[model samples]
Target: MPVNLPEIESMELYPVAGVKLGWAQGHIKKANRKDVLVIELCEGASVAGVFTLNRFCAAPVTLCRQHLAGNKGIRALVVNTGCANAGTGEQGMLDAKKTCNAVAELLAIPQDAVLPFSTGVILENLPMDRLLAALPNAVNNLAEDNWKDAAYSIMTTDVAPKAVSEQLNIAGKQVVVTGISKGAGMIHPNMATMLGYLATDAGIEQSLLTEITKEIADLSFNCISVDGDTSTNDSFIIIASGQSEVQFNSREQAGFAELYQSLLASAQKLAQAIVRDGEGATKFMSVNVHGAKTMAEAKAVGFAIGKSPLVKTAFFASDPNLGRILAAIGYAARECDSLNDLDTNLIDLYLGDVLVADKGGLAKSYKEADGQNIMNRAEIDMTVKLNRGDVDVTIWTCDFSYEYVRINADYRS
Candidate 1:
């Protein structure tokens, strides 16, 4: 079960003015599921995207980069679930291009104006026959208030739909931002097995939007880890429709900071939701590392602890095996190039609010029962005071459970 995740029925999401979403039952890999999604943008919307760093990325990821580089002014996005379309050679690229071309023709736009995304079992070819047959159904059903369905349509292994909305007043005009993301496993920094789309009514210059996309990715998508595996079909896109009166040409412009913060808040919520809904996750952990010389060194220690199988499993069994964490931190300082020698004698480790370890060993006042109590909670916080420099970073992760292995063992069955 997902750790401390909210129910979809309790969510109320706002819609961006120029974006309309529609979904269809394409049966890409399963019957009666919403597997095809189309999101159409208005004429003047500006789009920026960040993709996976995996060397063998999916076919649609390749095509999406090419289409965005073409500068034809993107007008629509098409997504399919249950077939990654990776490791299929040249036919995969052709299939991806065909999806873009078909969506463009349906919307009466240039072919290069469309971006495509896919998620699911890797190395298998996408089921184009069912996907193409379902396109008309999705396109004809486009509506402005379908964010919930759009979220569901993109799920592969996710147990819950991740979506969020934020509003802020800019120059007395109301600006709206809405976004959705999906991921459950094969999650790590450098993106994940996920697809995120964020749309706003406030206008942003193309160059600035691109720069902000990378920044937002670093702060949000790049700060989560689950199962320590990165996927080949990750994508995060931001679209500014320029439909509202609040428009900015640069970071220094008025209202840009407010609007950007709203967007960042929305992104952080959506990104954390993925970690909360991690596959077979029973405990959500926030690993915080402070007093580092640089953000990179802080993140290195956080990930080293977050991705360590021994550390994750210890939390799962409600064990206070503190040595595993200290071991991870030691190796992180040695492995990461950004940090010089680290002194554990000056470090302090806390599980929840209780100080457990310090001075290169267990604290005299630390109790095993206190550590066990925090580990048993649905949500836990691990704070590390590196005592090196002054940078602080937070990485979200989840504990591995018996069900985690069960799910992956039978994933293809």
Candidate 2:
């Protein structure tokens, strides 16, 4: 069950002019489910991506870097669920290459222009025969309004399809931004976790698109955690089709800021949806850490609180265990590998607006009932203040529950 998240009943996924999507059931692992996706990009589209930092990254991830580095422009994206081509050694790389090659051949584009992605069970080889056989069908089924199906096709353990769409006027032209993301566990993204694809029809330079992709990812995908275990196939990609005819030369252009804001908002909604649908999650939490010396420190502090099993369980039980939060903060502070720089005496903590801890201990005005009232909500706001500087960051997470344990323990079955 998802935590306080609503199903996208109408699924108003807007179509960018240069993008088309399709899916097929290759029976790679399961039967009767659409487990493969193909996203076809037009000839002039600009694409950029940020991938997982895991050293044991998947074969598709390696190929994606190589394809993007070739600077030949991305033409198509081939993705499969049910068999993550990871931990299969050189064979995995070959399988990823073969999938890319098939897509490129079918689309009549250069092999280097195709990027492949996979998710689901690791340490297994991709069923090349089934995947390659389905390529032509997926290609034939491509459509501009298949975003809803594409969203569902990429899901692994996600309870529902995650997608968002936004439209804003850029230079008097209607610019559309639409995106989808999927992840229910193993989510602490070093660069970007799970898989997210955001596309815009507004015209922008390739270099600017790459820069903004990383910038928006830091504020969105990189700020969320589900199980604190980073996956080997995490990737987030952004494509600018330049189909809207609203050209912008620099960030100072009139419509660029609005476009950027709309894109970021859409990306953030997709990211938060993943946390709300976190595997076995019952509560959605916003962990904010403020007054840090740098953005990195603030993020570290927020992630520490968000990833703490003790704190997560407390949230699940609606227990105002203030000590658990403080302990997590201290541990996170030390984990930063910086000098012993955190001073508890200068810290303050709040559950919603009720101050629970101050000067390193329980606040003078602390009340358990107030904390309990806030904790009882399906959505929670946790704030930590380290009266040391001005920087702040927020991370999204979910309360762990019995279902989370059950889901993972029997995941492979």
Candidate 3:
């Protein structure tokens, strides 16, 4: 069960004009499950993405970088859940390329025009035989409105598929922004904690998209954590298909700002959904760090609290242990260079609407029962005002429980 996460019902997901999606039950990890997906883009679609910063990234991640670096237009994306093609050395790369070649062959496109992604169970070779056998059916099944099924296909531990869709007018033309993401465990972002894909009907110049992709990632994918472990196969991709009349090639264009913000909002929703559905999560926690000298400092303080096991477990048990949180902030200040001069005496901590700590220590008017009342809720907001400068950032995370350990301990079985 996911913590306070709503189960998405049969909902509308608008399809981007030039993007089509298909899925197949490849049984990459388990039988009778939709474990494989393909997203085929029309010719001239512009695509850009950011991947894990981990040095030992998966084979498909390495291949994706090589393909994207060529600047040859990407035509399609293939994804499989289960048996991450990582730590298998040369064989892994071969298997990844073979998966691309399979998709390319089916689509009558160059192998270099395909990007591949995989997730689940690190350090194992991909089951290529089943993957190859599934590609033809996946390609044959491609359709413009299959976004919902596509979301389900790429899931691993996710309790429900994560998807967001929006329709907005840009320069008198209608633009559609829709995206999906999957992650439940092994979550932390050097780049992003899981796999995400976003597409829009409004086109932008490749160079500009390449620049803003990182920006979109920073504000969305980079601001979340689940279990504090960064995955080797993490990736976030954004695509723009020039099928609508709202196409633009530069940031200076008339409607780019509106389109960009819509994309950002969609991306943020998808990212937050992952934390809400975090593996064995019992509480959805928002750590807001304000009045920081820099964004880097704010993020450091937020993650320090978000990833703290003591803080997370205490939240799960509905305990407002203010000491655990204060300790985390003290250590974050010590670790962040920008916060070297951080003054604890100027800090204030709030749990939801109640002021628990004021000016570095417990607020005189605060009571234990008041703190407990806030903690007992399934969602919590912990605001820390560093009073150092004016920057702010929010980190989304979840509380750990007994089910968290149980889920991971038997993950392989």
RMSD of each: 1.2, 1.1, 1.1
Residue pairs whose backbone atoms clash in candidate 2? none
Give me the runs in candidate 3 sitting further than 4 Å from their true place.
9-11
Which 10 successive residues of model 2 have the least lDDT summed? 332-341
Question: Relative to the true structure, how large is the alpha-carbon lDDT of every model?
Answer: 0.90, 0.90, 0.90
Taking all chains together, the TM-score of candidate 2 against the true structure is 0.98
Q: Against the correct fold, how does model 1 do in TM-score?
A: 0.98
lDDT of 1 by residue, 1-413 (tens): 67777766324778789999999999999999999999999998999999999999999999999989987799999999999998888999999989988898899999899999999898999888999999999999898889999999999888889888877898899998999999989999788678999999999989999999999988988899998899999999999999988888999988888988988888888888899988888989999998999988998999999989999999989898988999899889665886557888988999999998877789999999998889889899999999889899899999999888987888777
Model 1, residue 396: distance off in Å is 0.2
lDDT of 1 at 40: 97
Per-residue lDDT tens digits for candidate 2, residues 1-413, read 89877676334888888999989988888888888999999988999999999999999999999999999989999999988899999999999999989998899999999989999999989999999988898999899899999998999989999999888876677999999999998989685459999998887888898899999999999999988899999999998988887876689888789988998999899999999999999999999898988887888889889989999999999999879999988887565755167899999999999999988889999999999999999999999999889998889999999999999998889
Q: TM-scores for all candidates?
A: 0.98, 0.98, 0.98
Off by over 4 Å in 2: 9-11
